[model samples]
Target chain A: MIVFTMLNDRFILATNLSLMTQQTVIVGTLAIAQTLIILTAGIDLSIGAIMVFAQMTMANLVVTSEVSNVAGYGWPAALAIAAGILIAMVAGGVNGFLIVRFELPPFIVTLGTLSIFTALTLIFFKARTIQGPEMPDAMTWMGTTFKLGPFTVMTGVLVMLAMYGIFAFILRNTAWGTHIYAVGDDPDAAELSGISTGRVLFSVYCVAGLIIGIAAWITIGRVGSASPNVAPNINLDSITAVVIGGTSLFGGRGTMIGTLLGALIVVVFQNGLALAGYDQAPRVLAVGVLVIAAVALDQWIRKVQG
Target chain B: MSTVPAILSGRGLVKHFGRVVGLNGADIDLFPGEVLAVIGDNGAGKSTLIKCFSGAHAPDTGTMEVTGQDVLFRSTHEARLAGIETVFQTLAVSPALDIAENLYLGREIRKQGVLGTAFRMLDRKRMRAEAGQRLQDLGIGTIQNISQAVETLSGGQRQAVAVARAAAFGSKVIILDEPTAALGVRESARVLQLIHDLRERGMPVILISHNMPQVFEVADRIHVQRLGKRAAVVTPSKFDMKDAVAIMTGALEVDEADQALGPVRTPAAV
Candidate 1:
């Protein structure tokens, strides 16, 4: 008890607030998006592709479009963001349509799109990363922060949290959310109950697309460059967070809190490993192993309960 | 004074699957506050008849009335709008979801804000409370939790849950497709009791089963189908297992003895 007291007193509670907040926000956003798709018993293999495509769209607009000059660099950035979201949503709609209409397996469908989207990105940017003018002052304000003594927080992180809060509400308290689970859990039952299983699947992929767009924007702001070859591990990362967060791969069972916690666990482990000077190969291996173990454990628990 | 004009009644219902006739000249009357057991052999038109009524198929020849209003259901959703809900032989219950969640699968309670933005929220508390009340109303006292998955429930309990969900969401008529064909003695008995309870609540029930004892035990009336035809309708007190089996196998005839026992057939083969 004395040691606990000393540790609490010596450690300024807010000292790590800025770092924790931003990191959590980033990881939380990705995890929530992953959770949404996982709950539908679907895997969005193209999330990484969607992200890259969105980024490339934004970059190309800034470099080639007239809006960039008119809005004084800020306009291009804004257009880039909107265009990214639109592209992602369109991709999402396509995903929803194909999966629902053709009754194709999501695995094969998304894999096909992953390649198509990445190839499109290559075609759009001519296989080169387009460097744009600096982001607008107002847009940069979103990435800015102020000091709170030894702590700091970025607006981007706050934005990520706000998105998480909204997503949490939707998952916990919406008819659409319940419908998603219903459709995933039993398509025939859901349809018999008067649910348009097609509509639910459509909405799911579209929403996933929207979330991917948001992720793309954040990613672009952080890295300042859109590269197709980069962030190839994003799909695995987001899926890992979702699985570790306790969302079942089988669908119809998930919680935003679980996803957030799972994301934190993943991000924390990665950061800690890097801090301890672990090599990238070992880090990748560890994360891969952890994902498998989490899934295995979930299955074991289900069997024992049964 | 029949209150609802035979909520769902059909005359000379005929359905053919190209070369095979699923339901041929079948006539059935499903009224409120009663249980009608549609019993037949495996290839009998029970499932086909159910599919037609549930909007999975449109009858090639028949006049169906809902509350005395003539209508042709193009899809299951249409049947649901007319308050005809069917719990399929597959049960149509998502094993992955909990009781309340499954109860309100498609027709979930939505809380809309001003201007109907959907705040997009669900009244989970209301859903749970109503689901609990519905389960209780059906005399299901052993349900451990509303949050417990449907897969965890026994076959009897699962059937009960499916029935309760049908009753809770679909109001006019609830159809059960071989509901108890998968249960044991005690379990089947429990489901039979549930059927009675449903009838007591004034909910019309259409039970499809091949189990003769169960048919005699629970059904207020039984309709025997043989080779896609309405062979007979017998009340439990007047039910004859031999006649039922004969009719199910298309062996029963319009003989002098049959005529003395029930109604006679005019200008028909014996």
Candidate 2:
């Protein structure tokens, strides 16, 4: 990209980089949660649905009631946001409970929930889109722009970056982090070693839900509205980022920093290709190639043993 | 024979998996500081009995006594807290984690003060240092790098790590489930030597194995299981491997009066 942009100079602009960061606010943040679930060898297909559900919850809570034949509650901004986050966490816990109780695979479970949550969002919110004017200042605060060393940056971008740093540190230096890797590496071995596999798995899903809740908030800030129709391919995008960032889909071998870079790589390819005058087809094709290449690399690395 | 009481004993233990009977009515007695080898055929309830002792399975009808006090284990953690550690046939070591990390996989040391208390930060330097010291103390020199992942190590070295973990924490009892089944002859020798060291340290061990010569070489008393029952308890001196094998296969039956069921060695001797 650097070499290509050397002639065009379109992708090298500070303004373009800042806009790309703002554009990736939602998918990048969701990738943080995705990285965690993938580390446990689990995938969250309902991540986007969960975020949409929670964001719509926040939007519906603040919007006026009876306009769309739905009860909006119209609570205060702070209380409504908290309730949305709690709802996301409960949704995550529900996934955890079903997977642990029935011994169901995470892929199948999360796949079922993706449609469930999407339907729930439409039913509860009446499929209404809440505009920025209808939302409270606290809700759109993440979208607020500020100057940072001659570059315009959204508060949401910095917030997502901070999350990446904090989680990276936690995954590297904590006992819970090591247990995550151990459990992901082999759950039966973890159980015999005295680590409660159920508890670890449950905690992971709950934590993933928490991050999704926050991503919902960031989505409102960056997208400038709360819509159930946004980011239709969200699960695929976040997964693409994780795979491209070099985290093993097989679990227990990835890092948070790699996930952050993975998210950027996806955004960079799309942004860089656009600047180079390539159409959407080529941009999508590049990401598809990257995902396959990354997985093949992961398989080759895993075959080398440990 | 000495009049030494069993350190860990179970009476009339019964366990079933749906319609299949695992242990119909099995009994076991492990004296202190002695290697009591339990031998049985494929369906002779050997693994089932060992699982009950290790708290991996709950018996439907049983009375277990540890130090003469009745105790029932609900989980593997409870059994470990009661001073009984088990090395499962799977070895139960995380393949991706380093040797030191695997050594303290479940029980990890945290950093001191705020880092440990608040953030739950693991003190890697301290854990690695202590793990190295532990390997040295166990006389396991096959693995030198504490940070090397368990998957990169040879089969014997991985077994050594598992045995070291069991020996380090198990103060009262250590149960090894087919510790040598996947190992080569030399690796088997190292594990058998590990059993000897644990016994010399006065830790009672319950060894479940299909190897006849290995059992005869290490066992002070051999318990034969047949058709989900304690067929007979015989000592190495009174009954040879052939008799033990016959009792396991139900080809020979020894009278209760002739069985050498008592402890041949006492805890005081160690």
Clashing residue pairs in candidate 1, if any? Answer: A173-B122
Per-candidate DockQ vs. reference: 0.60, 0.78
TM-score of 1: 0.87
The candidate maximizing TM-score is 2
DockQ metric, candidate 1: 0.60
Q: For residues B7-112, write the lDDT of model 2, one tens digit per residue.
A: 9999999999999999989999998899999999998899999888787888999899888889888778888888899999999998878998988888899999
- Local accuracy by lDDT, each model: 0.75, 0.88
Across residues A1-306, which tens digit of lDDT does each residue of candidate 2 receive? Answer: 685577469787889989888888889999999998899888899999999999999888876654433466778999989989999999999998888888899999999999999999988886778887776799899899999896999999999999999899888888888889998899888888888888888888998899999999999988899989989989999999888888878888888888888888888888888788889999889889988988888788868854
